[model samples]
Target: MAHAYVTFRIRLARHALADFIASFKSSGEIVVLVFGQVLIGLFALIAMPPMAASALPFYQSIPLLLAHGMAMSLPLFLLRRRVLPRDVVLAMHPLPIPPRIALAADALVAGILAGPLALAYIVSAAIWMSQGPEWLQADRALPATVFSFLVTCGCSSAILHLRARGPRPGPRLRRLTTLALGEPWRGPRIAYLWHRLFWLPFWRGDNVIGHQQSALLLGAIASAVAWTMAPAGIMGGVLDLTASASLILLADRGDKAVREQLGVLRPIMAAWPLQRRALEMCARAFSLAPVALLLALLFGAGLWQHTAGHVYLTLAMLAPVLLVAIPRFNPRARVGLVVASIVILTAVGSEIWN
Candidate 1:
């Protein structure tokens, strides 16, 4: 029976792989991935000198490289569906394969897709390192390269898992939003508060605003472990911790926003009921109102800071929220207006900031 099951799983995996490939055949996602690899390769070739100069102590540089690698991989993982929903779309079709097998196949395909880019990055890093000062050449580029790959894999895995397991916004947002707006503010205050507080860790965890609470705590613990072996700068440790925390917080916020937006459109969701939709609407409203208030506060804070960088970042972040709010003013003009605003704002912001 065990042997039979093993054979069955193999067949299922093969079947899943076939489906996965077929799904991507016409998607043009692979073309985009190839183009991106080429662009990165070109950029690396041009920027080799600066990149080499940026290298630090092996210990310090390793984490920095890993962090950068993870950051680079993150957006691709996060926006994978925008290219092709190959995994979800393929999984939806009726097949003898189990969901787990299908998921594994999807992962395998994604790994294959990422392999070229990973190779290019490694080559680029090696070339860059070779151009650095002779003393720095002693730094083990192989270990750093391996670390970067590991970071990319870890981040990609985490993002995929989160995407698979995170709360489905369509149902949750529709239900929550409907409840908040349909009923008076007094109704279910405790429930509403609980929901609000649930995402607070994610908000407070944001790195941009400098609240790296979780990352700092983890890094401090790691630093204490490292200190047992050698001395580490307290300031450097704090900054690393903060950066890690901010990265996590920012990722969480981005995912939460996407989920909430999905909820707003839940009314059009074929599988959900009116009651669920109503509740989701309530949740969406509740989530969005505070976000707007937060943006206003951020705008004020940015003005107070009087730094062009902060002002530009604040504006970049708030542009989306403002675009989201446009529907309220004129529901019919929402989509076009939002798209236009985003284009104009992004173009202007990039020109000014860059």
Candidate 2:
């Protein structure tokens, strides 16, 4: 029975991974972005040992080492939700599967998600061994890598288990949102309704406000990191670009979710054209509000290395609007175009404008 359960989970995860990869393959831009990120990460890992050993002092290098390790393990952490889809989680939660078997299944799924990173680490390890640096001894590297893998997989699995069994915060979150939006007493009924509609995506999911909250959190963290590493050096430029890309991705997800919701309400929207227009306006405002605020934080905090950085930031700010405004291309293709454009703009800013 345990064997059957584990097998079922593996099959489900396989299907989910296939679907995820297909989505990635469907867009040339996304494929490029994915490959580009992987290559960049591989390069960083390959440079880690030498960088740690000689570039920075030992105290400074500790953070660098930890950061690189986290970077290597991040794929499994981020894609945990993707590999074990909510449906699969819901299906498996009621089973009588043993704890050890369930854990093993989760570790296997995490391994699958982190496969490319694993390969990258192996290559890095081989290179490090060939050099045999005294500071970053090759012997210690294997144990560190193994520990990172175990911790990452175990944490991801634990999070999955907790989320599956956790209480749904959707209802309470909706009430708070309603209160925040000035629902009954403050705004006009149609305006309130449409604006409320804009926020429906955040609170509708099993993970209450997970999507938008993540974007906000990332923006905050990026700003904080940039501020901490003041003077906007190479790392700052990279963080700025990376943060913008992450925000664009989050905006893409939120925009897709809102559009999906609107699609389901097409009949009602058609019946009330004013409501549709109002919703459109509300969504644009609501979606761009965070972008505006984050940009303000960046500017006020002096996080931009050069004035040209704002140009790329502006393009990122416009991405969500352009993503919805442009209708000729499919969403996936549109995303590719938007991301590619931003990347190019950032490259131009970094290479020429500075």
Model 1 lDDT tens row, 1-354: 333323443454456446656644422332333235555568576323224423565666766776666765765463444323445435544545565654564455446545766777667766666676454443455555566666666666555544544234476457656764655555575445435433432333111212333343345345323322332355443333332222222333333453444554455555744455445445434444433443344344332243543554454456445543333434324334334443443333233212
TM-score of 1: 0.36
lDDT of 1 at 84: 34
Per-structure clash totals for the candidates: 18, 0
Candidate 1 error regions (>4 Å): 1-117, 138-140, 143-287, 293-322, 328-354
Worst 10 residues of 1 by lDDT: 204-213
User: Top TM-score: which candidate number?
Assistant: 2
| Candidate 2 per-residue lDDT over residues 1-354, each given as its tens digit | 558766776787788678767655534465366447766665547645433443456576555555555655555545556656666667766878787776777666666666665676677767776776666655445655655555555655665566445335577767876776665557676656654555554555444345545655576557545643544467656655665555555556555555656677777678764756666656645655555666666556553665665565567566666765654467567766666765765564454233
Q: Show the colliding residue pairs in model 2.
A: none
